[model samples]
Target: MSRKHQWRGMMGDVAEKCGTTVAIALMEKLGGAHFVVPKTYTNRGPMAKLGRELAEPFIAEYAGQVVDIPSKLATKRPPPESRFQEVEALIDKNYTAAQVAAELGISQAYVFKIRKAAGAPKISSKVDKRQKSLFD
Candidate 1:
């Protein structure tokens, strides 16, 4: 696939797993925004591309550093964006994306979107639609 196509595909897989809109998640993910837990994708191609993108900012700093040190401080580091941190904190002990939206007072669709964008699977063991609110 073309490079753009690869990024798009990787972005798609990320969108599918993290449960947030593709655009939102991709911006956070590709823009070097970090998360409490780095998301991984089932598809390798896209994942590799994203990994490279993420590493670009760090390559220069760590160019000749010891194994323990990163070449540089990643362009963005020390606590990634909080976009998904709230939701991540609400995940079940099993690391499942359960009861996040209800707890955060956000749309379940958005919750699902973020989780999927974070690399959650289609077959989440999570309880879907149970967190719905009248105001949603």
Candidate 2:
């Protein structure tokens, strides 16, 4: 199904379970708005539950009135000053880049970006030496 139809169906389900007002509010608020769902929703069970409860009521009241979902409300968090430090710490603790990415709910590429930004030595690979290898 199309995303719009899917959204409508989900909203219908929410309304059926929660109430029409709550569902309508949620649909209107989320419709055409770009936001990320935070890892806290996955990490802290109680906070996530509470967040869901808090979301419905406000969603109902604000709905189409809101233009942009604020960072405080949405999952798009502020940039961390210690992102590099966090990555370094994980590496020092013998965590693989993939492990760090899973832990941080980010991608391996993002971990590499953080590693590069920290001025760490690049990981040399056969790909890097390919032309030289071919000539030799």
Candidate 3:
């Protein structure tokens, strides 16, 4: 005895019924044009050097944003010894300092200090994992 084999084609009719176009589908995929938005910064590369040169050092009366706000309140204090581990976990999870601060119920600035103290790795401002508003 012998058997015949056959293959069915794509259900383009179903796709059509779903009302999705080829261009629309591809644009919504990862690395697609629909979702990703490129960042726009004021200065970059060589301009950053020039910017630094023109930047002024913090002054006593510069009117800082968090004046008198204790940096210690940035994140939860588990213990002095566990600071590194805690900070490491947050970084590994790619959470923003603000996210860590919020999770640990503290301030974003303090979470930044923990990161500095641990020295886990470099984090990019543009690619902060937690996707938080900088002003927050």
Candidate 4:
């Protein structure tokens, strides 16, 4: 059988024994690694990283077995243009460049670039000398 078939079979077994949620968590966490499920769940074991609740079912079914999880589970990124549009929309809503960058997981510089490209006014950080302080 092909490696893909083997991977599917292993994942199916995990899903059947541990439920789909555990199977997916295993795939996401242990993908591309030959991970051995311990016979007994331990806080110090490799499965400990998954936390007890998520690790127990997998250990019950796959104890002492080395699972070869595929590496194709990486999340796909949205297109660059779509991301740019998202930045643009956030800027239009008057979100600060830092806020836009944090919300979109992009750099502040990239947010500034998008703001400039959209012809949005730059947000100033300097305090006005003549402005009265709220605490005064």
Candidate 5:
């Protein structure tokens, strides 16, 4: 499929999963000031082609009224308190942050935050001054 077609298909899937109103809200959120069409579509004009097709449903629903979708609307709740201990245990078991985050339905950045807050040791490979240098 063409890239444009793939994008439209993905958007359709999003619409199907979240309902038209939510899909439109999500589109507007991603579109910013342009709103109806996303930047990628506008940048090259392919998205602009489907502008009317996409907008009709949303326009009819809103009756030309302007509305805002709250930025703070939470899609999913924060990982449970026990998740912190789980994160620590997983780290002890050598689980990567990405793995922990995936299992916990949270972001990898959040996993790092939990680790930092828990005083976990940094997992880095810094060359120690006492170690013999390859150049030496």
Candidate 6:
């Protein structure tokens, strides 16, 4: 299904009435919680951050109502198999854990964990071969 269709109920209404950009901002800022829309607009707080153009209509419709915002992860996470495949592909390219983490927007530790799970070869550390030994 299309990403647009995934938004349902109040979220879908917000997307339809306030534009997708505003809806997305709201989701990013207030998802996974019950947000109380103020009866009146003010110069501060979440509504103010959303700006008058978008916030006004929302307040008009949902004021005095506690609206439940969906979690960002509900829409954003890919399937685990796909994620594993992506990590495996990066490993196959000989990317280091740090590089894989940065590229995938995950932690380096997680990349290492994935490497361990996949039984991939250990990433070699960079050490200058010409460095003089302390004992020498």
Candidate with top TM-score is 6
| Model 6 error, position 55 (Å) | 1.4
Q: What does candidate 5's lDDT look like per residue over 9-89, in tens digits?
A: 334454554355545555554442333333232334323433655544544454333433323223333433435788877
The Cα local distance difference test for each model comes to 0.43, 0.51, 0.38, 0.68, 0.51, 0.71
Task: Return the TM-score for each candidate structure.
Answer: 0.26, 0.33, 0.32, 0.46, 0.34, 0.46
Candidate ranking (TM-score, best to worst): 6, 4, 5, 2, 3, 1
Clashing pairs in 6: none
The lDDT leader among the candidates is 6
Worst 10 residues of 3 by lDDT: 1-10
Choose 2 or 4, whichever is better by lDDT.
4
Instruction: Output the TM-score of candidate 4.
Output: 0.46
What tens-digit string does per-residue lDDT give for candidate 2 at 1-136? 2123323334434445556544444444454344443433343422233356655454444344423322222223333334888877777666778999999987787688777866775544213322466556
lDDT score for residue 88 of model 5: 72
Clashing pairs in 2: none
TM-score, prediction 1: 0.26
Candidate 2 stretches with Cα past 4 Å from truth are 1-81, 123-136
Instruction: Please give the lDDT score at residue 71 for candidate 1.
Output: 15
CA shift of 68, model 3, Å: 3.5
Local error of candidate 6 at residue 89 (angstroms) = 30
Clashing pairs in 5: none
Q: What's the CA error at residue 19 for candidate 6, in Å? A: 2.2
> Tens-digit lDDT track for model 3 on 1-136?
1111111112122123322232123223221121111122125422132232221221111213221211122122343335657755876787767777888875676566666666545556335555788797
Q: Tens-digit lDDT track for model 4 on 1-136?
A: 1123233446766767677777677767776678777899888856876789999988888888877765444223232344667876765676777898899887797667655665655657434445699998
